[model samples]
Target: MRITVFGATGGIGRLVVQQLLDDGHQVTAVVRTPAKLPLTHSHLTVVTGQLTDHQAVEQAVSGADAVISALGPSLKRSTTGTQVTDRTRTIVQAMEAHKVTRFIGLATPSLADPRDRPHWEHKVLPVAAGLMFPNALAELQGMTEAVTGSGLDYTIARISNPTNKPATGRIRSGFLGHDKVASTMSRADIAAFLVAQLTDSRYRRAMPAISN
Candidate 1:
């Protein structure tokens, strides 16, 4: 598969790109600062650009078979004024223009995947994330619209509190945040599942959550 990824400098993005290369897929990683990506592979192509740049994004999406985006704001870090929704919007537009659809995105667990979630777990958490981080919640909610409204085959892998754990390659996925600290998953597992989606057609449009 020819895969294009956004937010390739982040922890999860880097892991996913590496895993894709190891899986023998052609990888094109799109990043804001190409110098920061730091990867060398015969099959890897690193492009420097952010999502708000339409021409740059359009060019990036030109020949991709699938797109897996781990793009989002850092709750603890600061870098730019860009929102995650803008990136999703660019991916959606580029996919629409190029007739490429399969989009897999990473999102927060607070956004309920009501279908895959238990009733009470779905209710309380999203409400809390909304109450505390209203702005971030709003940004993610806007992102939900950006993906769902894109008219493409999309999957939102709503992840738990992501950690930098080894890729055990074994993890559980669902909407079960009611289990206390189990609402956290490793960053590598999220990338694993994101890449897994590309090989399995059943994941299209499903919002699956990951936890350790």
Candidate 2:
């Protein structure tokens, strides 16, 4: 399988790229700064461009088996809270133009999933995230809306409390308001789950929260 990855320089994103390569899939990493990502492999192709660069994005998305994004929130005060939303919209357009169907992206619990039952964590987490970082929350919510409405085979993995610990490969996936889900998940597990979605159809067009 050939995969195009966005946010390949990020914590979980880097792991996703490496895992994809290790799995023997061809990877096209669209990154702003190629130097930020030091991994080099025969199966990896690094494309230099921002998401806003339509031509470059199109080039990256064209003839790809799937597109995966690990984009996260930007907490900088200068940010207008639409960073992820705007960039994701560009990617969705590129995918549509190129007739690519599969898309896997990341989000937070602040973006509600219809399957989510009324739980204390669902209520409190969004509220606390909003209070602490309003802009960041808005970015995630916007991203969710864009992807869910893009009319593509999409899976939005809503993760929480991403830690830097080693990958346990034991991830608990559930709705935010459920007791089965925990508060923290390692970045490695998150990356593994996201990469696994490339071939997993169980979560197509579904938003499931994951934790460990």
Candidate 3:
């Protein structure tokens, strides 16, 4: 499949891009600076541009079979600084213009249905974090809303902690607020799970959570 990735220089984004290439898919890595990405594949096309720019996103996404966004900072300060969700909005518009479907985004567990979370933990940790990072969470929420509202075939993977460890190919994914929640997952696993989603039929319009 031909794929386009925004924030392709981020931790999870890079892994996702590499994994997509390893899986034999043509990948277009969109970023502000192409020199930062460590890609050397003939199938990998590095496009330099900012995610916030509409024309740049459209240029990267054109002719792609699917578009995946794994853009997020490991340590976030304010929602205003988060670009993934905002970038996603532009992506949605571009994809529609380009007529591309199948959008897979790396959202957070915070966007999961409130009722699905474990009650006690929900009230304390996750819920508190949601309030604390309203903007950050909003980005994910906005992306999900935009995708769903855009009428695209979307799968929002609300992931837990994404570590940089080797890909184990094993992790747990549940609806937001699932009782058994772990705090982390290797970035490798996240990327692999994303690749698997390209063909998975069970996750349409659903938000699936992942953790180690």
Candidate 4:
């Protein structure tokens, strides 16, 4: 499979790229700073560009089987307020133009899923996030809305707290309130789950909150 990845320089994003290469898939990574992405492989192609650049995004997505994004807003308040949202919109536009359907993007539990039942964490987290990181929360909410409304085969993997621990391959994915999910999951494991979605159809057009 040929894959194109956004946020390739990010923590989980880089791991996603490496995992794709290790799995023998041809990879194209689009990023603003190519130097930040240190991976080099015969099957990996690095394209330097921002996601907002339509032509650059299209060059990355033109012939890919799937597009996965580990992109998220900074925890700190964003000055522009809609950085991730804007980039996600650009990517969606590019994918629509190129007729690419499969899209896997990231979000937090703050983005609600219809399957989510009543839970305290689901209730409190979004409120806390709104008060603490309003810009980031808004950015993710907007990004989620864009992807969900894009009319593509999209899966938004919502993660809980992320740690730097190694991949366990033991991940729990489901709606937040209904599933017994841990509060923290390893970044490596999250990357594995995200990359695995390239072939997994169970979560197509569904947002599954994942944790350890």
Assess candidate 1 and give its TM-score to the true structure. Answer: 0.89
Error of 2 at 175 (Å): 1.9
Q: What is the lDDT of residue 26 in candidate 3?
A: 95
What tens digits encode model 3's per-residue C-alpha lDDT throughout 98-145? 999889887766554534745443456557666676566666667677
Model 2 residue 185 distance off true place after TM-score fit, in angstroms: 0.8
Q: Indicate the TM-score of model 3.
A: 0.87
- In model 2, what are the clashing residue pairs, if there are any? none
Which consecutive 10 residues in model 2 have the weakest lDDT in total? Answer: 174-183
lDDT of 2 by residue, 1-212 (tens): 99999999999889999999999999999999999999999999999998888899999999998999999878775667576789999999999999999999899877678888887766887898888888988888888888898888999998878999999979888775553877699999999999999888888998998888
TM-score of each prediction = 0.89, 0.96, 0.87, 0.97
For residues 146-202, write the lDDT of model 4, one tens digit per residue: 999988999898986999998888999998778887668999999999989988998
lDDT of candidate 2? 0.89
Query: How high is the CA lDDT of each candidate model?
Result: 0.79, 0.89, 0.77, 0.89
What's model 2's lDDT at 156?
92
lDDT of 1 by residue, 1-212 (tens): 99999989999899899989989999999998887788999999998876788999999888899888888765633333447877778789999999988898877766766565455656776787766666666677778888887788988887757888776777676555433335667888878888888877765776766676
What ranges in model 4 sit over 4 Å off? none
**Which of the predicted structures, 2 or 4, would earn the higher TM-score when compared with the native?**
4
Residue-level error in angstroms, candidate 3, position 76 = 4.0
In the predicted model 4, the residue pairs found to clash are none
